[model samples]
Target: MTATQFRCLLACLPDPLTARVVRLQRYVLVSLDCTGCQEVGVLLKLALLSARAGDLPAAETVLHLAERTLRALAGHDHTFAPPRITRLHRPRPRPARSAAAPSPGPALAGQVARWTGTRPLVAATDASWKRGHGGMGFLTTDGRWGIGDWKVGPQDPTGPSKIIITELRAVQLLLSTVEARVEMTVLIDSLPALSYLWRWQSGDVSALPPGYEAPHLRLLARRVADRPRLRFQHVKGHSGHLLNEAADSLAAIARRRAPGFDVEARASDLVDSFLTSWNQQISA
Candidate 1:
């Protein structure tokens, strides 16, 4: 069947039935000897169709099958090669930075010298999403931290996009609490959030996804533009990074609506030890 016809048929069926059909089709396609380019195209369409039907497992299975089929076909047919199946969305090429763009390190140092006249503070930020609610947390080098939560709105993008939005919200919350004149280095785990910040820093405001007009995102762009002393660095999540782990735990606590703990609490003591060890390591 044509992809259009298959999609129309899937639209008519109930979700459970559609999922079963998707699984069955994946099995059948995997078993077939798909030698021709047209057959490979059909498999690609089927994979896309399965994904659109919300049968992600079946879609992944079909994609693997398609990849294997293409590889086998390539061994015999020199004219045809498989395309990269994993990269569903190719990123747009970024323009080169203009000569007027300020270097982050030197520019931040100059700003700090003119304003704060002290060393820049280091901070790590993290976010957690559960049950349509997002919690954000940030911990600074000075042993200060903050946690906040946001509810998912009807206007916000759902699914995977929501996590990216939440990550951005975490940054926005951090920016709101901190003084703009204070030179600070913010560490985040989300690449998409960092990408948006970097793009905004380069004066490219149109880099955000189409139809993604979150108010917090606009505010974040403006704040980042205004504060040239703010430097963003990426930290890998779930690693043994002390401040990141503490920030992550705080975010989880906020999201779960757990009991509040004072600075002398057990969690605080643990974080204090972490900070001490981190400081010792840095000084060493």
Candidate 2:
């Protein structure tokens, strides 16, 4: 049967939960022969859809399957490969950034207020793309940090992945470190990225997010759905914000090192120095 036929049958199921599980199973079937980051990507999208539909059991099951698939394939030696999707649609290009790009709409204030606390834990995330390589990094004011490159495997035929995708990936990495159910705030520099995420969190998931970043965005959406207290704050890039500059610098470092970079051994004084510089400048 065709994929459309299969999906139609799933939608006709009486129990929404059952239908969600079946849809997840369909992704698992696709993953059987698919060997790459693409397989994991598909599974994550399924999980995200299930979460948005309010089917936590189904989402968790798919997430578990994805984890198992990654573990099973961990020992294989392979290079980057283009995903074998049936139809890869290119999203329309977004317009250039305006000099005075308006702040996210007032609706975002209401959407964000539901998830914020008086003093939420805060972190800054950034992504960088150079020479077709993508990297993302995040750092909290209290010294927590993460840095990593995209999993495109260097055979990225779709050209460089969107910076928004890398930024969301950094969000995923940063949030993954937080304890479940706790309120958190993530400071970001990309307005478009924030808009994309807000749209998804508000249940407008009909269209795919830009590039191959849907899975990452979906994962983040699920995290938000489960914990409504997580908030995202947009900060101006290159405005001498200490943590933001540090995360941006780390992402640049990750892109330069590509494929293999050590985060643990990287110097920490740069972040501290930037914070000092930002403070001294502000005082001046």
Using lDDT as the measure, which candidate wins? 1
Candidate 2 per-residue lDDT, tens place, 1-284, comes to 22432342234223654443453444433433344445765775666555433356676787677656656666431223332334332222445555543211000000122222323366788988865567777766445565656545554533333666778777766665455676667889999888866776676653345345334456566665566676778999999777788889878766655222233345255555554564467569
Q: Clashing residue pairs, candidate 1?
A: none
- Candidates' C-alpha lDDT: 0.59, 0.56
TM-score of 1: 0.52
Give the alpha carbon lDDT tens digit for every residue of 1-284 in model 1: 42323443344234655554454343222323333534554665666555433355666676666656655754433223233222322323445655554211000000111122224588788889877877776667766655556676676553457777767767765665567798899999888788988988888766664567544466567668878898999999998887788778867755654323332253355456666777777779
Off by over 4 Å in 1: 1-119, 153-160, 259-271
**Residues forming the 10-long window of minimal summed lDDT in candidate 1:** 103-112
How many clashes (backbone N, Cα, C below 3 Å) per candidate? 0, 0
TM-scores for every predicted model:
0.52, 0.52
